[model samples]
Structures are given as C-alpha cells and as structure tokens.
Target: MYENKISARQLRRMIFIETFGAGALSIPAFACYKEQNGFWSLIFYGVFLAGTIAFFIIFSGKISEENFENRKIGKTGLARNVNINVSKMQTRLKSINFPEVLPQPIKFVYMIRFFINAVALFYFFGKTIQTVYMPESSFLFIIFPAAILLCYSLYTTLQKRARFLEIIFPWIITTYFIAVILSFIGIEKAMQIGNAGELWQGILSDNIFRSMGNGYLMLLCSSPIEFLLFLRPAAEERGTETKNRKVEDKNNKEGKNNREGKDDKAIRDIITAVAGAILCNVLFCFLSVRTLGPTLTSQSEWPVIKMMQLIRMPGGFLERFDILPIIFWILCMMAVLSGYLYYGWSIFQTRSGGCLKNFLGITFVCLVLLTCVVEKHTLLWTFYLKYKAFVDFPLSLILPLVVWLFKRQKDFNYQEKT
Candidate 1:
C-alpha cells in the first residue's frame, strides 16, 4: 500500500517537516519554557511552530522544482525549455564556490560536538523519565536500546515514505503540538507551580526573550535534519525524469542542443543560508522566553522546580484525559529519534571514509553514557543552569558566524581569479 502511494515531493516534506522537530532536542525547549513561563506560554509557542511550518512549505516547493529541473538537464545531457530565475539554491551555492562537492570529514571536533549533545540529552532524558515517569533500575539498558531503535527506525522510515520528508514532518509537528497542549491540560491543578500573576508578568517581560534564544539553539540540532529531509523528493523527482529522458534521447536531441542559458550565482545561496539561520534563531528566542523561559530552568530538576512545588496545575478535565499526554510523548520521542537517526545514517552513507564519522559516533556514545552516569549520581546537579546557558548561547552565535567567514574568503578568491 505504501509503495504505490508515496511521491518524491511528499518524501521531501516528511524529512524536513517531521524529522526536523524530533524529540531528543525538543524536550529541552519544552522544559525551558515550562520552567520559565508556565503553561499559558504554549499558546505563543503554537503560533511560532505554525509560522515555521508555513515558511518551510513555501521553500520546499521552490527547492523541489529546481531539483526537478536539474534532473531533467542531467537526464537529457542537454538543457531544453528551461526558464532560469534567481533561486535560494543558487544563492546558497554562490557562497562556497559550491565547495567542489567534497567529502565531509567527521573529525575530532565533530565527535566532541556529538558526544556533548548525546550526553546532555541522555542525562536530561533520564532525569525526565525519573521525575515524570518511573525510575528505571538500568539507565544504560533503557536509553541505549531506545536511542538505537529510534535511529534505525528513522533510517528505514524515510526510505519507505517515498522519501518525502516534508509530508512526514508536518504530521510529526502537528502531533507534537497536540501532545504538548494535552500534557499542559492534564497536569493536576493541585500540581500547578508558581503564582499565576508572577508567571504572567514573567511571560511578558525578559522571560520571553530568553525563551526565544533557547528556541534558536534547539533549531541548531534540528536544522541539519531539515536539510536532509528536502533531499528525498528532490532525488525521486530527478530519478523519474532521468528514466523518462533515457527513452526520448534521440528525437529531441537537436532541439535540446539549441537552447540558451544564463549564469547562476552562488552568493545568493550563502546569504539565504545565513539569513535562514538568523531568522530561525531570533524567533526561537522570543517564543522560548514568552512561553517557557522562566519556568524551564525550574521545572527540569533545576532550582526553580524545587521552589515551586507549592503551585501545581489543576487537573480539571485533563485528569480524565490522562492517556493523551503519554501518547503525545511517545509520538514526539519517535519524531526526535527519526531525525537523529536519519542524519547519522546519511553521514555514514555519504562520508564514511574519514575519521570524522567514527569520531562523531563515538563521541555521541560517550555523551549518552556520561548523561546516564551524571544524573544517576547527581553530578553537576547544582550548576546545571550555568552549564546549559554556556552550551546554548555560544553555539547559537557560532554557526552563522563560521558560515559567514567561509563565505568572505570564497568571495575574495573569486575576485582574484577574475
């Protein structure tokens, strides 16, 4: 049934939309917001999520069309009937001289990044499980198996979905939102924390700004997954056109040879990438601060959660709706795993020759182990907020800056060549 139905475009949508917003990283965003802003902040969060989804939809359409055109050109080995225009891809490629499509190295630094994220997420996930669910006796057994399964499932799922990341992503996103809202509704009113008035004020003030920053940082982990997601539909479309052109190579050969062409810019592509980074990061900060910034630090085993034990959400109708949040969490967790797994596997497939991939995988494994050990032992339990701040803020600024510097060097070299 699935085989006959899925298309390349749909697969691209799924990868970008579904996998991009996965669980491993999103929980931190939720935790941050809940700790700082309290429950009502979710309203604003929903709005922001909706807006990004819309932006993704428009961009995905443009990218898919260009990819299709490229495939046709490749298939016929000639350019025909093609109308040239300025596009996001052209702009992005302009910055790096297209980098000659070199193999990506998974070096020591890449491994370090992976390990840090893995360990952090592992610890956070364990703590959450202990607090919100039952404390498992074997943390390693629980986390490792869960992580591996998620990765494997995601790798298989994307291929099965006709490689439509965009289509899959929207459903995942919608499911995640519903889950969060349902969880908010289900918390017992008796379990609600913080004074309503104070929380509201915090939500309106600098708290929202903090949330926005965290949101941007979270996007960093997810953005790579988004880029890969766009590839599925693009690939499928190209493949289809390639097959069709193979059959028509003779009759249309002369006309295809008689076509006109224009220059495509790589500058625009780089600018678009940088612009996308900035816009996403800024919006993330506002949403995080407004909805979950103040309460996030507190709720997630931080100093704040301890202080606010007195105030709790009234379960109200949610008490009757207990099953919903559990279901939502399950779905969200799946989405997150799918994302990480998809990217990890893709890395393995495309660039396994270098030490970088091995290093990265090992680093992530160490991180997962470290997190389990830290939480179980209560290590670094006190300075958690400071540590989190360091990780989130600096990385958010560095990604775009590095991209920009590389772009500058490329431009200078281009001018020299001219």
Candidate 2:
C-alpha cells in the first residue's frame, strides 16, 4: 500500500521542520511570562520529551513486529480466522487513525480542534507576511495568495513535500544560524550568563517547577513530533527487502534481527531530529531573552523576530539581515501549515466516499472563509491557549499511549492462547 516511500533522511528533515514550526518563536516569551530561565526549562523538558519518545519508539516497534508476524502467519490456515482482526488493528496502529479509534462525538471534537489550529496557523502566517513584508497591503490580500498556494501544496504528494523540505532545509538552517550569531552583537553584558554556576543556579531556581510545567505545555503545543507517528511507517528503511525467494527463505531466520535493526535506525533518526529541533528552539529562546530583556521579550508578539531586528550587521554589509530570518520563518510556517492541512484531510479521506473530492472542495472554501472572518487574532490565541492543553495533551500524548498499551495487552493475550 505504501508505494512512494521517503528515505530516513527525508523523514528526519520533515520531523525537524514540523517540530520547529513558527510556534517556536513564542518559546522565550512563554518562559519570560512564567518567570523562568528559557534555556534551563527547555533543557529539562527536552530530556523528558526525549525519554518519552524513546519509550514510544520501543512500543511502536513491538506493535510493528506483532503486525508483521500476524501478516506472515495469515498465509497459513491456522491464523486465517484472525487475519481480519489483525489487519484492522494494524491499520489503526500504523497511521493517524483517530477517526477509526474515536467515537463520533470525540471524533467531531478532534476535527474541530485540528480545524481551529489550522485556521490559527493560517491566520498567523498571513499576519506575519502583513506585519513583516507587506505592511501596506490588506490582510485579505496577503492571505489570499498564500491560501491558494497552500491548497496547491495540499494537493501534492507526501514525497513531493518531503523533497521540498530537503531542498530548503540547509538554506533555512544557515539563515537562522546567521541570524542567531548576529543577534549576539551589541547585547548587554550583564544580561548574559557568566559562568556554569549561574547556569546551574538558573536550572535549580525556586520557579523550576512552574518552568517545567510551562515547558511541558509549550512542548505539547509547539512540537509536532506526533507527526512522526504517522510518518514512521511511510519512511523507507534500508536493507529490509528480500531480493528473491531463495534469499527470503535463507534470511527468514534473520527477519526479526532485520526488523530490530530497522526499528533502531528509525528510533535514532527520530530522536536526533527531535533533539536537534529542541536545541535550536532553546538557542532561539536564549537569544531572544539575552538580546531583549525579559520585559521586552514578554511584551513583544514575536520575540525572536524582534531580537533579529536588533541585529546590526558588521560594516553595514546587509542593511536588513532580519529579512532573511523572516523569509526562512515564512518557509517553516508554510511547511507547518501544509502538514496541518494534509494530515487533517487524510483523516477525512479515510472515511469519505466517491464525493470526497467535492467535500474537500467545499471544506477548503469554508476554511478560507473562516480564516478571513476570524480577525480577532488575540481572542483566537487566548482561546487556543486556554484549551490547547486539554485537547492536544489527550490527542497527541494520551491517545497514542493508550493505543500502545491496549495493543500490548491484546498481543500478550494472543500469545497466551497460542
């Protein structure tokens, strides 16, 4: 069923881009608001996140093994009766099968949650363009072209999206790194951390608990590593194919080892990408706090971007180096917006009928109209922030863990019966 598979490298890039979306720009502000050191909070949360993801990877591997074994056994009469059940479970486990797993009311809520998030992101994208590049342009005009482009992108294949990310990943990283480096110039010396003791003290300060809580919430809302749950099965692993019947039978005994190797590689790639993105976010947050004091950082809407504007290029070589980060930030936001649309649409596609295309067309029109009508960006942000913890936590973290545990128990029971 998975014909157009992306390489592990492409998968890593996708994860990084998704995890480091435009939401990351607000990390420093969030830290400042909570009155905590952004660097320390991010480090602590990042370690916790990495550990959780590692456990999830292990669980996913076990489920994949069970699925593979069940498929293999289905070729024989002994397991024929359980093939349908196994296939259903595998389908639910492999992808974002929320529509299948969730009840109608809960599914409706999930749909609404994702829709609101997509609209907010779309609105944010338009707002960024209007604020940074086209201050004179109408908001509608700014988003109209962007919405059209997003629709076109949504129509494209996953492989195409992954390829596009691969093409721009290096450029985006370089631009961001340049901005980060330039941001260090002309900053107050006292604002910077002087020694390891200061850094350690920051980590163990009185507000550490609050900082960790806020960091966890930020990680939940900002990091889209949950996308990896859907992407892993589609990511191609090397040395997993059998060339011929002879080779297949010869290596049949080694199949488990091969699967283990593939799982290990996937785990490593995902962890690396996630960790790199987290580190980048930490650096950006740290720079924002250092360049702009906590007061300004918390007050500013886009602290990182504002910090970029404070950058003074040496020798006046680049009059406005901030524009580079803006452009790259827009690219990252585009990837994130595309991911939201694509994954949300995929959920509908799974259950829809022959009129699915028509339904999507109507839905696109409504989405664009909603984006246009939702002018209260502040209210949207408030609403999202107020309820995101409730929704995203359950959907992203709780749901997957519940599914994994259920599958594990079922597999164990099956083994006992056998």
Candidate 3:
C-alpha cells in the first residue's frame, strides 16, 4: 500500500472532489430555492445534490482510469519496480517542507490571507452568535483574538501537515452538504405560507446589497482563478510531472502558426478567468436574492433566532435540531474567508514585485469588513450609494484595467522579439 501510490491525475480528481463537494450542493440549490415551490424546491435541490455527487464520481473516476492506462513506459514496468519507485517518491514528497521556490516576501501573503480569513470568518461568527448567543458580544473583540490564535495554530499545523486534506476535505464537504440540505428544508418551510413575497419586499425596501456586503461574494469566482494564476508562473517550470501532461501544447513542432496558437490559448485562458469572475458575480446576485430577508433582519438587530423559529425538521436523532440557520451563516462565512485567504495568498505570491500586493489585499479585506459592519449599523439607501462608488465600481472597472495592462505588456514583449 505504501509502495503503490496514486498518480498526479488521481490527486487532482481527489482535490476537485474534496474542494467542490459540499460547496456545489449548497450554492446553486440555495440560490434558486425561493423561486420554486416547497415540494418542488425540495425535489430541485435533491436533484442538484445528486447531480453534483454524480459529476464528482464520474469525473474523478474517468481521470483516474485515464491516468492508470496512459502510463508512461516507466508506469508499465514490473509492478515491483513501480512500487519501489512509488515508495521512494512518496517518501521524498513527505520530507518536503514549505514550497522551496516561493520567495520570502511572498510569505507575507500568508499573513494577509490569515488576516482576511479572520475578518470575514469572525464577522460571520459574530452574526452566528447573534443567532445563538448574544448579539452584543463586541464580536470583533472576541473574533480578532480568536483569529490570531487560529492563525498561529494554522501555521504550526501546516508546517507539520501530511495528507491533511485527504481526510479533512471530504469531511468538510460532507458537513457542508448536510448543512445545505437543512437550509433547503428551512427555506421550503418558510415558503409554504407564501413568505417569499415578504422576504422579497424586505429586500427591495431594505438595503439588500449592503446586507450581502459588497460584491465580495462574487469574488468567489476570482478566488479559483487567482490560484490558477499563481499556478501559472510555476507551470512553465513544472514540466510534465503534474497531471494533464497528455493535454499539453506541443512546443517542439513550433512554427509561426503554432507559436501564435499557443499565445492565443494563453489569451483564451485569461479571458476564461475573467469570464468566470463575471459568472460568480451572477451567482452572488442570486445569493443576494436568497439573503435579502436574513440580512435585513440581522441589520435591524432583530433576533435571527425568531426569524428561524418557524423552521423545523423531523425523522432523525438530530431532527429536533433547529441549527440550520447558524450552519448556513457559518458555512457561508467560512467559504468566503477561506476564498479570500486562498486568493490573497495567490496574489501575494505573484505580487512580490512591489508593495502593490499588500495594497490590494488590505484594500480588499477592509472593503469587505466595512461593507458588512456598516450595513448592520445603517439603512440601505445610504449604504448602497457608498458601496456602488467604492466596492462594486473598483472590481468591475479596476480589475479589468489590471488584466488589460498585463495582456498589453505580453503583446509588447512579443512584438519586440519579432
């Protein structure tokens, strides 16, 4: 067992299954739940959950099987030989510590990641406490210190980490799935008496944008791409050791046309990343729609517990549990903060060229926290005006400019060589 380890393709499939498990179920289902009837909503969400799990299994299996068959000459060697090599590789990989190629300044990105992770996560924790415990716990006072502690613990644990995700990722996703199922049930019950209209009215009448806290939710799209980009500068260095080697663009046969095609593919990938960001914006819009009722109530300091009091589930040892609201809020916060940290690290790793990295991460985190804190304190009319000028405008406008500038630089370098 120790000698014969899975290949990189298998690892990637595992990562996808691990990363996307609970998240896939919750996002689309929760977004559209209010738009459909309770019985139908339950069925719709059920299908969504089933579809996601199926996709994971089928996709992962296909990739793993493909890797198994497309074995390099070395892969098809004697089983004993392959096992010995596998054991050696596994031992070597285990002995590795921090990514050696990463520069020291980039480590600061880890710090910023932790900081943003703390703020987004703890802020929501405050709201959760609002639901279960007291709302007046000066959540920051509680959460800030907690963030520091968690970060320190995280640093130590990560240094010693080995196959942590292989175990934890599946569990996190499963927990997330359970939480979403519960939220769906809650949403279904809430909609039974035609309460959707009331929530919609509150959203329209109240400040839903501020409640959702800027377009930070939309940053979810960029989060994945940001990591991909971080992976990019390193990709040109990785050779074919990682997965998807078979899909690599041919460089040896390069002619003018092939070179242009490669450039075009790079351009296309960047555009795809940008397009993903836009799709996330749309998804966040849906999430904003779902959240209208909850945010408005939270802003008014209305007991979130009371709002959820009508929601109940039955049929299990945990059926009497009414903690779905807290779960949704916490998971949402966890996803957002974890995303911020992941992207913040990517940006940090890439931006070691200047203080620009620090500026971007700090600005992003500050805006996210401010949007949430102020929403709870003020009305929608005033907050929307502020949010539009500050948050939404920068992401929509400034982010494009950054991409455009990078593309232009690449074009100029190509022209100079020609």
Candidate 4:
C-alpha cells in the first residue's frame, strides 16, 4: 500500500534537496560579490525569515478534504482526490470551484512561468555539468542522464524518487561540508577573514539588492506550496508528537479538530527544509570569504570551486589527493533539474486531466535539450530568466490570494451547514 508513498520526513528532505540545488552553488559568490561579510545576515533574513512567511502564506489556505481522502496511486501517473463521500457530492463539488474569470488565465500564467523556470534551470544545470564534470563531453551527452532521471521522477512514483533523495542527500551534504572544512583549514595560512565590516556597512544600501534577490530566489525556487500537489496526510492511528498535544489538551478538543495536526506537521517540515537551504547558502557564502577573502572572491570565475581546489590531502599510499567539488555540484544541479521538471509535469497533468502523460514529459525534455543545443551558450539562458523574471512575482503573490478566497468560501459554507 505504501509502495509509491513517502513519509513526512522524506517529503521534507525532497524540498531541502530541491531548494539547495542550483542556487547554493552560485549564490555564495553572488552574496559575497554583493555584500561580502554582511552576506551572512542577509542570508538569514531573506532566505529563512522571509521564506518561512512565504510558506505559511501559501499553506494557510487550508487544503484538507478528509471526506475525499483517497491516497491511491494508480496508473497514468495521477494520484487524485477520489470523492468517496458521494452523499455530500454537492459540497465537495462546491469546494473545488474556480473563480468566474481566473480559471483559464491562472492556468496559462502558471504554465508559462513554470515553463520558463524549467527551461532556465535545465539549460544552466546542463551547462554547469559540462563546465565542471565532463568538459570534454558533448553538451547533449552531459544532459542525457539528467533528462532520464527527470523523466523517471515525473512518470514513475515521486515517493520512490523522494525516498532516494532522503537517503542519499544527507551523505552528499556531509561530503560537501567535509570538503569545505578541508579547504578552509588547509588554506589557513593564506586566508584573510577580515573586512567583513564592509559587508555590514553595505547591507542597507542599494548594493544589497542583488544579495537579497539571490536569497529570495533560493527560497522561492523550492516553494512549499508545491508540496500540496503530492500531499496525502500522514497516517496517524494514535497521532505522533501531535497526538501528545491532543492528549494533553482535552478542553481544546472539538469535532475533527485533530486534522489540524497534519497542518502543524506540514509547517514544521517546511521550516526544517527552508532552514537547510538557508544554512547551505550561508555556508557557501562563508566558504567564499573564509578561503579567498572578500576582495578576491569577487573576481573569480567560480569562486566556490576555487575555494574547493585549496584542499590538499596529505597521504603516503594515496600520495596527495586533489580537490573534486565538481561531483557535488553536478549532483546538486541534477537535483535542481529534477525538481523543476517534476513540478512542471505535475501541474500540467492536473490541468490536462492526465491527457499529456509521457508525451508531455518527452516533449518538455526535448524542448530543453533542443534549446541548449541550438543556443550553444548558457549566458543567453540566464539572460532569458532575467527578462522573464516578472512571471514569478505574480504567481507567488496572486495564487495565495486565490487560495485565501477559496478557503474563505469553504469555511462559510461549512459554518452554514453546521
């Protein structure tokens, strides 16, 4: 029964893996380049504090239809909310209502932004892979495996894919941390950890806009609302930690109020995931200055890689091993690609009523590949994202309003019926 399903912890890790993907590698340089030593404070503020608010805003819409709780994962790559309480079919139908004017426009806007996100991420990820791991390999060769993994994640069980991320992601992070420490410790003689004051001075200036933007993008990229698409409430016979709260407070108890436990758990998981992203970004930013100093960090091609190359392993039998951060980066970039592709495919399926299927999946991947091959330059793709950046702001701000309206209507009807 749980074949294609993941536990709450796994879902949280998936968000972490997704959030830390493309941005973590590059954001540090952007942060340091923009704010230097003071980048640390901005990372905390923009990515963590603001990000948590964004997650809550999106989730506060309250999407629990316990009467329609059908967690079955069937063929055709669709897991739907089967309305088993057919006697209340009218209310269930009412609950799913769309705004009179926003239905088509909403779907269109969502797809366009989602498409732009997928394309930019895919191209950059593939380009980064080539630049780092296999410089000699053809561009198509670098992207092929990533495309395959993305397709599998989309067409197959997301739970299985999420579980895989849950298991291996920790090790990848550990490896990254070890590499960073080794790089810093080995370069202690050359390191100049001072001049962080300038970063602090610049924090409030217009100069910090790029740093803030980088942090916000890191948070935005792995938004928690998408979690709703795959969510089926955690099975609670006795309820876990939340049950303790339930058993502790009898006076607070009301009919079906226990459902709120899942809501709390979801919020906790989102906080955990966003915290991880914040840490990774901070560490990467610190890695730049801690190794290369503030001034030098701004002038490098990939400053993070430069920091990594400082690691000098001492050994007799192994001789002196060299640095290899490309492995970690390649893995991260691949994760970013999968995250975008999976999110886009999920929304497409929901909107198309599963008609797109694998055909939609194949076409999307091909478009990315074709574009990369044709353009032959990653900078153009980055420029495209900047040009179309307006697509994302409205999605984040507008969709939450829609969900809020939906919830308001839902509660009014429920109160009238009760």
Tens-digit per-residue lDDT, 227-325, candidate 4: 443443332222343443444323234424654765567657766776777677677766677677666666664677777666555553222212345
Instruction: Output the number of the TM-score-best candidate.
Output: 2
Clashing pairs in 4: none
Which portions of model 1 miss their true places by more than 4 Å?
1-108, 151-158, 161-240, 243-320, 348-350, 354-368, 377-418
> For each candidate, what TM-score against the reference?
0.49, 0.81, 0.43, 0.74
- Put down candidate 3 lDDT per residue, 126-205, tens digits, no spaces: 55465456656665554554344333322222112213333443454455346445545655645423377774554455
| lDDT of model number 2 | 0.67
Cα lDDT tens digits for candidate 2, 1-418: 3334577898888888887765667767876665665655666677767866765565555434424332232234656554454333211112333334443444455456667777878887887777877899988888877777777765667778889999989988888887776666634443465589876776666376776776776666454666665577667643333222234433344655655676677778888888888778778777877667666877876887787666554577777766767767788888887777776665555545222556556667876888777765467667766566776655666666665666668768988998
- Candidate 1: what lDDT? 0.41
Q: With candidate 2 superimposed using the best TM-score fit, by how many Å does residue 227's alpha carbon deviate from the native?
A: 0.6
Q: Name the TM-score of candidate 2.
A: 0.81
Better of 1 and 4 by lDDT: 4
